[model samples]
Target: MKPELENIPLVKNEEKKRFEIELNSHFAFIDYKETSQQISLIHTEAEPELAGTGAAAAVVEKSLIYIEESGKKLLPFCPYVFAYIKKNPEWKRIVDQRFEGYDKL
Candidate 1:
């Protein structure tokens, strides 16, 4: 059976500026940069072993949850994150209003 996304422990490796989760021996992560009022989600990645296993989505979800709880605006710079937010419109609330593509999402 596939692992549960909710059961995965998301770690904010602030030193690395990434939120990470272990998948087997590898990690799925979202690269981000934070400012006083906004966080730019720069990229998302999952190892080959973790691909197609929802790892990327899991990381994105957890990262978005964290951003929402922190009350910071989000600039979803990565295409995957952008598509994910487009699919889940409710997440748009956390998007930075100044983002060039905010209205497009």
Candidate 2:
């Protein structure tokens, strides 16, 4: 059986500027940089063991939720995050307006 999303604990490591979740013994993380009004998602990675486990999406979802709750705009420079937002347009409301029409890129 697959693990429930709630079972995974996503943590924001402010000192590392990343959101992290543990899978097995490895860590999956989404790297980001924050300013007063915006947060730029720069990268995302998960251990090979976590592939196909939905761990990446879980972390991204949790991170985006946090950003929304914090009232910060998101700049998804990371391809994975960009793609995720594209697929989940409801989350686009929190995206930086400067990135409007980014799909054309």
Candidate 3:
């Protein structure tokens, strides 16, 4: 993570069912759906300008931390989230083993 993005604030907009962060005048977010016991991360997006800015990684990290702190299982449906976890394996601890492709992680 870039030092500038290390502490980016995360906002959970329940109405939109997404977690967001503002970065360098644009927004990066992860779309999610929640059940009683888990959150399914469905997609991740960032403004084109955010490319190479580390914004995507920052928001993903923040959202993962939030899920851990909330004590809920994670269903990382988004390919981006899965790829991110592959790089940072510690996040597998919070993932719901029943996730359709858990073995791939």
lDDT of 2: 0.86
TM-score of 3: 0.95
Q: What TM-score, over all chains together, does every model reach?
A: 0.94, 0.88, 0.95
User: Candidate 2 or 3, higher TM-score?
Assistant: 3
Show where candidate 1 strays beyond 4 Å: 1-3
Query: What's the ranking of the predictions by lDDT, best on top?
Result: 3, 1, 2
Name the lDDT of candidate 1. Answer: 0.92
The C-alpha stretches of model 2 lying farther than 4 A from their native spots are 1-3, 100-105
Measured by lDDT, the strongest candidate is 3
Task: Show the lowest summed lDDT stretch of 10 residues, model 1.
Answer: 1-10
Candidates 1 and 2 compared by lDDT, better number: 1
lDDT for each residue of candidate 1 in 3-67, tens digit (9 for 90 to 100): 57788888999999999989788899999999898999999999999978898999998999999
Tell me how far the alpha carbon of residue 39 in candidate 3 is from the true structure, in angstroms, after superposition. 0.5
lDDT of 3 at 35: 85
